[model samples]
Target: MSQPRTMKSTAKKTTAKKASTAKKTSTGKKTSTAKRTSTAKKTSTAKRTSTAKKATAKRTTASKRAAKQTMASTTGTRATRTQATRAAAVEGAAAVPLPDFLASAGTLTLGQRKLLVDQALLILDQNYVHLPLKAAMHAVNPLQRLRVMRARMERQTAETMEPEWMFHRQMSSIFHSVRDLHTNYLLPVPFAGKIAFLPFMIEKCYDGAGEEHYLITRTVTGYSAPQFGPGAEVTHWNGTPIARAVALNGAQFAGSNDAANLARGLESLTLRPLVIQSPPDEDWVNLTYIGLDGSTQELREQWKVTTNLPPMTDLDAVSETSASMGLDLDSDEKARAKKALYVRDVVELEDGQSSAELKTPAAVGGADLPTTMPGVFRAREAVTPSGTFGHLRIFTFSVQDPVAFRDEFVRLAGLLPQRGLIVDVRDNGGGHIYASEFTLQTLTPRYISPEPVQFISTSLNLRICRRHKDNPAGIDLGPWFDSLDLATETGAAYSAAKPITPEDGANDIGQTYHGPVVLITDARVYSATDIFAAGFADHEIGTILGVDDNTGAGGANVWTHGLLAALLNEPPPPDSTSPYEALPNGANMRVSIRRTLRVGQLSGTPVEDLGIRPHETHKMTQADLLEGNVDLLAKAGSLLAAMPHRSLGVTTSFSGTTLTVTLNVEGIDRVDLYLDNRPISSEDLTGAPLSIDILEVTPGQSLRADGYKAGALVASRRRTV
Candidate 1:
């Protein structure tokens, strides 16, 4: 019986292979027979493809889990990804099929064209971040405007416009007109599995004279371009000058700003490899480069095929995974450590065993500074001659529990010895609003409300509650929603008439530090962080420092809705397709329902395309890129040093088995003590550290003690029992 079962399994596997091969052969996807003949190429392709898919899936799963977990606390949404997917899938089946827009888009009747426009307008009215802006941009009657757009697209195509292409063009017109960075229509992935690529990575390079050039960074496996090794300057591609090629490609993408568009162009030059219509025809391109030896060289390079480079979605998935982990796999050491841990866990799973749980071993001497760079969620302290600075780098606001995150943040902030704090939200895309709010309150000083000022509109509260009623996170947001007083419309999204009073501020925390606050930001700082930044700026609570470019203009609350599910008002079948998936390909829209505003700002103001500007601009030089942001930190420290510095005295004493810690905090108002790396006590320092008597010491047990004054570590002492 065992032998027969084994034989059947083998046969099934063989059949799958045969079927896959037959399909490929029928499609004539075999680009290079010579490469297929190579054993190494076959193995490499298989491994790479499998790895890429697994990575993409892992990332997608993690993100889904986070969304579900954070919903209750952040948005009061009880919707699970599974439920949403199923809803989309089920409704998609019954939803009125838009005219096969791709096949006969150009021939679409005026009514059919109007239907698409109407659907889009419906979404814009309900979910656009800034409806007032949208109205201003495209205020004409939906049907009339769509008719005009269709005519324009038809004129542009000069023939029967491709349905998929036309669909994107129509959406692009609306998005471009609105000019919102977060609002754009995506088309389906143009290419899928077994696609052709140039088999090399391109990077922006600068010479001593600061002239910019495109340089080949790395040559991918299974193919070699020795002539185009690293540092080889690409002067032209496929007969077009490098600069012209970049501009042509950049124009294809809609970026939030000039910097983002240029970045996309660089990416396109590297990844958007030439595609051949037929095998053995135009399968290669000529590249003219200034070789390593300073001699100009030209070579005809054949495009390489890789099953790993699946679709745009897969690439984005991998990139998202890498970003979420705060790892640049190509460089960062901590990223490599995390990758190794991931691989180890995978190995454990294959072995039918769970990975070993990490334990916090007893601290020896003092807590050792991590040798590798910290991951995205990290708290580090630096003691400078001027003062101590605590740097908190948070990548995303997504967390399992807002309360838990708040507690951890309080604990971590208490551990740092500092008169200044640097909150770095660089490259952090937004997540849970509640989690960010928690951090904000933890960092902000106590303040009393002056009358009931509206922070959010009643309409937004009602819509959010209705939409997030089934939040799987089981967080009770009723109190929060009920607390808001609905007022007139602000026109951005909601109206604010009364303020949502602060309940958790410095007064709520055990310790409060009146310190200089510096927030590090970049163009990638978006969404919830954008809210945090705007609030901080509006209140004059901190100084915003960024790399010249304003932070990302993503101040809208996003929700994924199936196009059909929303229109039909029915749950759809379970499908894991993302709302950001291209239209016409998938019936979904990544909708922004609620717009975020600064807490204390005037009404109708939103950080849309005009993101929060930095108080001081810092630019990254070539040396900074190579050596890390040491100079930036130094500058931040200098700015922090300008603020007055205060220190407190800490003393420890023991009697019998009781340990008494005294903090002579003069200027500092708060003090905390830790024993053996565990928080023992936190108290207000009123000219004295609230003396704590702990009777936990045992004979022969070594003891270590540390004290913090107003969230900064002030003293450390070790004693033997």
Candidate 2:
């Protein structure tokens, strides 16, 4: 798919805008809450969510605090009897009882448990890509765990197994231990489409003096908390310190690293996907906070359940590389329920530009972006310490059309400030592989070499590939067949590295923005987002500015069990491999079938547990949260100001069949031209626009120009006539 007509223009002087510094907000907060379960005690313990020991300790803590918060019926400001008595309506929603809701759930028989375990074992042993790496990095080996599970089930005399949630939890924990988000045990029914959340969200930001404070960033609209809202600082969770609570929560379902764990932990404090795991341990929580006006208060809120907002479904769910990076599925639309989930989201950008005018669909950041557009791309004309530039926040790369996505970004980039651009993918949970890699070429002049991926070289994986090689309805596994076959002789743990993102799609859209581009990332950036960041750094597009030390580092192509059942089967006449059986109930799972490897200097290195570290780290400040990221942008702008300014422009004119190529350039010392990917000419710039004439010219031919600085290629341009 070709891109939209490329925007063309000469290098224009960057216009500086007056920097506006809004008052920075810090600490102090409380919030309005949701439906209180009729019996908070009954709902306190979610089956499998908290261990028996933790549950007991939590119950004890609640009992001690039960007296302190006896005035829960009143608002945080100590509401009057009349104010407390005022009625609030909750439409189409129910107050569900807690642990009972899970305890009463259907149970899985011993046979069913075995089936699930066996399926996981086969998938992990034969198809899982990061087995060797994960085995080395993580203390617990999933394969070993599966084997132990199989042993327990095989020898046990009991006909019925634990409750369905327990069984799922055990399996889920096994997958989580690997610390790969792409691979997950998705529960069925009641849980699959449900989300468990609180009415308010919390976040951490550093004050000007570098003190860390946790505050209520936003609350669910119309929840009616007059006592507190944004800017409320949280000091404790239940009876534990807020940071300690976050860490405890993270220990339950954290990702690859400490940063990822803390991030996931913080996100889970407010919202959790029932599809991925059971609800929180407690049906309700008591948040101790300092109100914005210097008043201390305790806000006790109940956990609410909702299905109003569903994650955006994959555009092409049946594709080979499509994935679900856990069920907190993000979407372009800001549905009401989604708002509740993202109130404390790391980045939330609002786009006001019309689809037609922005020529794009976009995404993030807590900033109110001007000249806004939303879909996957949201841009604004930003003013910072270094003047003005475009701030483009990419919420996710999970798009249906890569070409259209790239073109839209190109269009949006052209319309924003041309001086410099800050591309923020903070909290972006990655979507399409092609979509992520395709956009990389647009920001850079260097070749966009999509990250390479490899599968573990095992017999089961080999057999599936061999059997499904000829099945047209299934995936194209022929590319990895030869390499897998050579594994025995070579003794390589993984197959040869190959890019899942086609080279053409990766490089089809050439550089569009000429100014310096900086990428803003956090630990939540995962899967395809990780791939994108790595490519950006590898290609030397610009300096990477990270709010966290590293990204989520979920580097692999994932496949759901359903997709596996369809493609990896060996039907009667040879349909894809049919090894996996019908799982009991509606249970399904996902596995990382191929592990991605870093290119360029880090070539051959796996990106499983280790994500791309930032070239520059930014400690998010209170100004970033309440003042539209002024400090973060200021730091970014400063970096952009110091980088060398470069440009490459080309035009073709013909005189009597001779092609005269005119080039206007800056900063770059040399330029090389290629026709149909073959070298055509080379020139050394002399600070003057140069015209190179070719004796043989075709009506239409592919043309490429490579720009070099300091003996190294820095930028590239492609054209056809």
Candidate 3:
């Protein structure tokens, strides 16, 4: 698709009157509160009765003590609210109760339990990818099992069935049965808020022998200190081995990959609250750390509450990379990058001239370089080897209009020192499909045509899906269905576009660039990012580097619903203040509806379970993550420099059933020979491209040759014998 016209530039202005009024209102509230306190003190003094004076003084003293404790806790000082302290201060203040409202699952009526069971079953039936629900339900039909479980729960009293009791019991089991990572239950409570958290951030570390161990990279100040500090080796947690604890935590999110689940669990341990009426006793966490001297030190930890950190929804957010390096969390300016709309506006200069206005996008610590118009996306550029090579760090494929990205690429590609282009999407969470598709299409070479196809398939019947009852995104299926040519068994293939050729103008930014492309990928790539990775890998468009295992397997798009609201007959309004806000006894669930299929075939593998594998493998070490990926970038630069200049020669001859393949190569180091399009021989030609003789050559077999330099597949040719 061609780029669309840019949106008009109308500068936005903030109204200051409202701000001033709000400030006045806030000050008035503070004054009112102070006046009330003063009035109460005066009234107590005015009560001249001796008995009344003693009572007033006693109450005031108790209030002061409570305030002092609160202040100490907030300041991260060791303020122990021991049994003795509770007994001495604020007599009759009730101790926090166990089995809070959230745990009142057992209290639910039979009808409510049945309703929940039926709802869960329906969701699974309509959305889960492995179609023919019965077949997908291998061990035991989830629907039937849930029905039986609900029947059993129906017999229990409110006290026995705690809120989230069923979820705790069956959610992991249901998720584990399916391969969908995105399909899981959201607890029947507010997703965010104060909860129990371990005082330190934990990460998986590997030793020289490839043995796995957990390491503490960061300790929340005022929470965990000294023993659980950064760089400490975590040998155990709460009496459980570190590995075992990770496994147990992973079991809670059954369908997710171990790495993803473990990461999530650890993030929860340190950041997310462990939802309860009051914080779990901090002393419950018994941690044993292995010191540098090989001696083990055991310590009891308290559950700390945080009011600042947000939930860990992204992988990049959870990593304790910075803390381990003794760096502050706010050290990087990029940390402040928030979602924004960058309007392209031009401001007239006082010199009677108009140039594109240069307004820097607000980022945590981002730059504001002078440019023509602003952008919605965040990108950084660097040139090396005296401007012979260019590296563009594309933080995301998310943009207001994907076509704008293509235009940006056009501008970047046209720049000098375009000998190479390194595109980094290491932790991209994904956005619009068009953005990902267009970007990948622009990078791919023309000779590799007839791009691999993609499809979306659901276990539910298409007719039901089209009826729009279960359509969460409210996707318009009519236009989408018409655009695809059916592949096999509900597999829809995208319509083919005219093959891009060299005839396309050189100045065209949409056309493929001459330089080799190096793509950096990691497991965190999800949704559209995963799609781009799959296409890039299948087409052999570039050399992929980084851990390929964490490719998000959360199916495709997600649809969320409030279980409580739906049951109450008062579905939330279009702009409900809190879509996720739980009802008195309600919960929310986000389910995966369609599984994304790339290179679609009825029986072909889906992209959710099988992600793109990189040509070269690399992992982001703790140091790499903390240091802004300096090592990774340097390695990528070296690879770009090593890319061979495209110059090739090859001759194949058949002599008495023997095939002799000779090559003329420059700047290339690896040559691979294929028999009938299947690889037969590969050799490292570091010195020279030497002739090779194939002892056996079938009468009808053909020979194909491919050349690689710096891990990227550079050249290819085919010859019939």
Cα deviation at 536, candidate 1, in Å, is: 3.6
Q: Compose the digit string of candidate 3's lDDT tens values, residues 1-721.
A: 1111222222333111110000000000000000111112211111111353353354345435533543344244212223322232232111122234233234445555556666666666644444343244334366566677767876777566655553444654654455444444444443222233443456664544656666665442233333234445676777788888777665553323555555544444443332212223233467766643344567654443322112112111111110001100110111111110011121011011111112232322243222222322333444343234555555444332334445555555545245667777654655434445556555643332222322234323233323322333222233233223242444542322221111111112223454667788765555557766766776666678765455544335434444222322222233243222332344434454444555423224566655666677655444443334555666676677776445446788879888888887775788788886678899788657589999879766766666787877666555567
Q: Model 3 TM-score? A: 0.54
Off by over 4 Å in 2: 1-104, 154-160, 311-318, 321-373, 470-474, 570-577, 654-660, 678-680, 691-696
> Model 1 off-target regions past 4 Å?
1-118, 134-166, 169-173, 186-251, 259-375, 378-393, 398-422, 446-494, 497-517, 539-541, 563-585, 600-604, 646-663, 666-721
Quick one: RMSD of model 3? 23.6
lDDT tens readout by residue for model 2, 218-315: 66544534235666677789979998998988888768899999888887887777777666778778777765555566766777655433233432
**In every candidate, how many clashes are there?**
25, 25, 18
Candidate 1's displacement at residue 498, Å, is: 8.4
* Backbone clashes (count) for model 2: 25
**TM-score quality measure for candidate 2:** 0.79
Best by TM-score: 2
Preferred candidate (TM-score higher): 1 or 2: 2
Positional deviation of residue 52's Cα in model 3 after best superposition, in angstroms: 85
